[model samples]
Target: MPAERMADFRPDAAADVTDVVCPVTFVKALAALDELEDGRILEIRLNDGEAARNVPLSLKDEGHQVLRLTDNGDGTCALLVRKVSACPVE
Candidate 1:
């Protein structure tokens, strides 16, 4: 429901990393995001703890736009990220 706030923008791609841990979680999401064109949206589903907290900031650091983060009420959350820059931060 909370994710509905951005109903106007649909994701270009989606990755589910709920089975993965912290670093790998972001890695998978990043990998999927890497395949997208600039300004495309990537929807990542991850666990609610560290992955949820860190992945968004990490993506932002990488020059991505973190659009929305929504709770599925099942210990998992969905992160909506727009790829603003495909280049990685050094």
Candidate 2:
């Protein structure tokens, strides 16, 4: 899907990890994903630099769809992800 549509996309679930650091940020996002159903969309709010970089990549690596990322212009970004599998591919 187009990146702009992500802004208007209504996710099945949403999470905020802007208060946390890396690893933990992705951890929380993963945990949230764990609770979601397949084909569901997750909207995650994360810190700008590391978490922003890593979480989406990790999700993609795990076979999920990293749909879109929008910078909030405040050291944070919103990530839209679609759950493609029940568990992460390890």
Candidate 3:
């Protein structure tokens, strides 16, 4: 079987870019999640590349946890990160 890759996530799923149009960075994604009112299970569907790979680590660094990682098998992956707790105020 082929190894699961993060880069594949991007092309497989089209970024909505609808409600939010900020730079599609991992940090931006986190910030968006932080600003959300509802506790979210954010499914960051991106190509299995830098953004996809770094998101989990970035979340961990910020005290958030990645709850699930789903590969769509079509060049996209879903990173389901629950808003478990707050990122400690700095």
Q: Return the top candidate by lDDT.
A: 1
lDDT of 2 by residue, 1-90 (tens): 565655676799999998898788888998999899998999999988889899999989888898888899998898999988845347
TM-score list, all predictions: 0.87, 0.85, 0.60
* lDDT of model number 3: 0.56
Candidate 3 per-residue C-alpha lDDT over 1-60 given as tens digits, one digit per residue, 9 for 90 to 100: 244543333321122212332235665666657655444556666666565577677776
- Name the regions of candidate 3 deviating beyond 4 angstroms: 1-24, 85-90
lDDT of 1: 0.89
> lDDT (CA) for every model shown?
0.89, 0.88, 0.56
Q: Give the TM-score of candidate 1.
A: 0.87
Ranking by lDDT: 1, 2, 3
lDDT (Cα, tens digit) per residue for candidate 1, span 1-90: 375568777988889999999899989988998799998999999999999999999999888899988899999999999998655447
Model 3 quality (TM-score):
0.60
Candidate closer to the true structure by lDDT (higher is better), 2 or 3: 2
Error of 2 at 13 (Å): 0.9
